[model samples]
Target: MTEQRPTLADVARVAGVSRAAASRAINGTYGASEAVRRRVREVAAELGFEPHAVARALATGRGSAGRRERIEILIVDPDPEAMSAKPFYGRVLNGAMRALGDQDIALEVRRVSALPVDDTDPPFGRVLINVPGAAGAAYARRGRTVALGRSAPGVAFVAPDNDDGGRQAAVHLVATGRRRVGAVFGPATPCANERKAGFLRVMSGAGRAVASADGDFTRARAYMATRELLEREPDLDAVFASCDVTAMGVLRALRETGRRVADDVAVVGFDGSALAEAADLSSVYMPVEDEAESAIRCLLDPARPAPARLPTRLAVRGSS
Candidate 1:
């Protein structure tokens, strides 16, 4: 069994000091003197009392510091701010917004398409990024972090288990007796890599080696990427794209490759976006709304054990 975490009261009791003195010493604010701060620090270190904003707020009235947007979700990406045009982002933003509403923490969504953010702009406590980019993260102040593709220690993320998805997809294809399997993936998103890895595992499990090449999550490149993958592995019977956007592209390649859908090539996709229903693409429908919800929850409960991977389901269709 795990031991209970220590609180400030525990630290004060051990330090032989009052909780008010401990608060001032811990926060380094208003009333504590140098000797008291030193004593408190020593005792806190001994008791393992990590200062918590929620706890500190209750003691110091910090949480009520007026919700002038204390929590900000800063997007660090080279891509244009076309969030309104992208279905994937819209759903994610919706979930995040709803979660924020429940928490009552002010939230700001900003994109860094332009360089050298104005210093006059409010500093965010946390930063979010789509693809890996150290430049954006390097800008945040010390109290915050630069969130990358998915979750990492001390940072929050909202991404699928791409590698597991890949493995699952591969296993599915192989179980179906597909002798040759290929994959097309999204840009360098963490979800892309995990799903790709999962697909590779499935193919390998089914005794098929994957021919790897990737496409940006778009219909055109996905189509072209699929064509090339199929050309390299002519006997390929199944294709997996990292997302539905790419699946659309794969559809074109499959139709043109002279291979009968499912008979010769069964295509599967991830991110089961609107295209899955609109175009009848075979895919694993990720609980994007849930993904958003979890991202918010993780951000809120930075203290909790990393939440379990969110759920997803396979949506079989004409393509598969």
Candidate 2:
């Protein structure tokens, strides 16, 4: 017969702490003083006590019948506030929250600059977003992890078809008879790089040379890049921005340069965000909400067909 597992009471006794304190420390719950927490954990480890995931979930009200598991949406950004300020990321969160509404599951949002180097198990599965390089890989190694965007090798993810969106943007401009095109591409992220690649592929296929500049997926950076592109190609008849926020800057720069929208230069953007709608900018409409929902599903059920890429469509407006 298997040896009986050490109980929370055993841990508490060994640490000379109350059972409540042991529970709090083991669960990383609030109200346990730092010294008590440390002592409890040490005693539990010494006793070979491992907190069962299901029991912990039940204690936290996340394992009741008809209720689903708790999950975390980890936004891997050092500056979470700045990241959330972007309309695209905000919409992703809104979509995730909507999908979670009144569901059997509980959701938590966390922002971390880097992955912790600890043997402790995470309380819940995680949906990683905006994490890149080795940090993303480290999180992927943890069980039951899914990504909100394309991630490192062997990681499951849900994201928009960014390359297709870029192609659609190019086709729209070309069909509208706009040549001498300029493009404002975003940073080195996978989505940004894919969009740029697709746009350039189509432009080259159409025998049109593209004047391109890089932006950090921000209005200010795009604004500066647009100025450079315009100066380099004065007769540029159209501009394709990697994302809607960057497009706002492109529009501003065009206006400052006394260029008329659609007549002098057509403008296209991505993300189909509210800003694009307000500016009447033609954009690629990606299903951000669907992506988020799918990500949650993937995390909950790893056996599900995963690494899904949602479709995109062109929303034509006055700008193009």
Candidate 3:
């Protein structure tokens, strides 16, 4: 009989750790301390215990050895309710799912306030979305990681062309003969910051004074901000919202103040979401789905080139 091949169990036994720990270490998963991971990997190598990709593929019915992999999309939002309430979340998931089409790899979304404190079994990779810079740094240490929407130091990322999107909105407003504009900028995330910068840059260049207010990227906050903006600049004839959801709030505020959209205040927003279409709001359309797809590709292929900045275009509608 052929000599028995050493299994993960044997590696775990020799490493004096649980099979799960051994697996996690071998897979470069979180949970295991660096010391433990190094020890387990050393033991695995000594025992000649190699993971069987072909067997895993057969068991999972995946097309290739890589198909059995699992990638997680981590949305670092503390408020689950508010995060889910946004239409952009669903749109992002839709794009991610479409990008994953027919792949045997599992894709999951997880919400967390911060990176996991313990090294649990890590997935094949992770896509970080809406995470803070510190949290992103922590998660990237675990394994292959890709950031969506914002770039982190020493990590791969895919993001929409936010600066250009902002420029597009400003150009549209200017072309439409609107002056005395106001802006409802989103939360202080990098994406939002870029959009704000782009819009402000163009507006400043055009020699237009813009009344601006900060919003938490929520409808209620935007509504309040819009009210304040109008109060500060009652003669404002155009408003640029950082996102479609915020744009909705802006619309409500305008209506309550008896300002007709387009005629009284040409409104523009970002994200090119369904809400924008339903409300006939002109928006900068970013290719979110393509970004998601590119993120996945980056995670799967380590050698894949850095993702380029996805393009954004203005979707003109009745609102602008």
For TM-score, the strongest prediction is: 3
Top-down TM-score ranking: 3, 2, 1
- Cα lDDT tens digits for candidate 3, 1-320: 99999998899999999886677678764335678889998998888888888643444435453445578888866555755667766766777777667766688788776656775878878888888887787788889888987766877789988999999999989888988999999888999999999999999999998999998778888999999998889999999999998999999999999999989999999999888999999999988778887887777555567677899999999998
* Clashing residue pairs, backbone N/CA/C < 3 A, model 2: 68-104
lDDT for model 2 comes to 0.81
TM-score for all models, in order of appearance? 0.68, 0.75, 0.79
Which residue runs does candidate 3 get wrong by more than 4 Å?
Answer: 1-68, 113-116
**Candidate with maximal lDDT:** 3
Pairs of residues clashing in candidate 3? 30-119, 30-120, 31-119, 31-120
**Two-way lDDT contest, 1 vs 2, winner:** 2
lDDT of 2 at 104: 55
Task: Tell me the deviation in Å of residue 121 in model 3.
Answer: 2.8
Clashes of each: 12, 1, 4
In angstroms, the error of model 1 at 95 is 0.9
Instruction: Tell me the tens digit of each residue's lDDT in model 1 across 1-320.
Output: 99878888898898888897788689764335567789999999987889887866655434665433345566644556346435677677777777666443556677765545355655424546562444434543343443534644435455555566666666667767777667887777667767776676656655677776777776767878887887777887778888877777787888786878777788888877887788777788877766665565555444334455665677777777
Superpose all Cα atoms of candidate 1 onto the true structure and report the RMSD in Å to 1 decimal: 9.2
Ranking by lDDT: 3, 2, 1
Please identify which of the two predictions, 2 or 3, would achieve the higher lDDT against the true structure: 3
